[model samples]
Target: MSENRRAEVDAALADVDFEKFNYQVVFETTKGTIKMDLYPDVAPGHCKNIIGLTKIGFYDGIIFHRVIPDFVVQVGCPQGSGTGGPGYTIDAEFNNLPHETGILSMARTNDPNSAGSQFFICLGRVPHLDNQYTVFGKTSDAESEAVVLSIGDVETNHSDRPLEDVKITGSEVIVTEK
Candidate 1:
């Protein structure tokens, strides 16, 4: 992400409330249920958008298309890859959330506002992304972080896209105490 672009996202979402907020995104994939822990206290705007999209079922059949080894597993589009989204944008809610393993966050293009309904689950701990991306949740298991990385990064001899099938069967919010 560019430094200028990062600044823009932060400026736009400066007013999002986070004092008493939380969210959970449960992705019911054909393989199994992948539940996401969303920290609105950290990324308020990002978490609000995620919950809104989930309630409307905007992520059905999406696949974990992009998976780089020791990086992250990107998903949350109707088509299942980073290539797909609601065709809109959300201002970057650049917060203090680190892109550590299992940290769920939004994905965007060079355009800081191009993050609509696409998100990713950090496969391994990538400390480099701290405050650069929005972190709304985390995984309950470190093992599952590897699972997302494996699923998204797996391909025939390292293709850019996944060669196998990954589907989100259902989606909903699962609330929990802070």
Candidate 2:
């Protein structure tokens, strides 16, 4: 998509009701396309940011900043995994959204409102992360198994982890009427 077209979409979304921002992500990657339902009801702004970045191709070629085997697979940093975004930041928003199976959350530093363009998908149900990370969406168990299994390497620490076989081809938002 062109930058102008993406900007138009972003502007259009700014007027959309928070609840109406709900949609699903069809992530077409090297493994496959995984469709995940977004919970704007939980974190509208975070989900909106995700949709906006995706529309602008901000996540293309961006590595999965952090991928913990049998835990979670995170991506969405134009800076390359832990270092990418739209050159801006958003104040972190918290809600009742819990970190459960397929839950989506935003990545932020110790400083709140520091979220740029990094997000993460819960590979499994994580109860400890409840009320911490900014969840935006969750992956459907049956949407696309290839996505969750596309891990190409294993890292020992949070220091510059990468998924050699995965790349975000693109994402689409299917907003629903409030």
Best by lDDT: 1
Compose the digit string of candidate 1's lDDT tens values, residues 109-128. Answer: 87766787778787667887
> Model 2 segments beyond 4 Å from truth?
1-9, 12-22, 149-160, 176-178
Question: How does model 1 fare in lDDT?
Answer: 0.67
What is the per-residue lDDT of model 2 for residues 48-114, given as tens digits with 9 covering 90 to 100? 7777766656666666667786667777766554655666777777777777656677888888788
Candidate RMSDs in Å, in order, are 6.6, 4.1
How much does candidate 2 score in TM-score?
0.78
> Each candidate's TM vs. the true structure?
0.77, 0.78
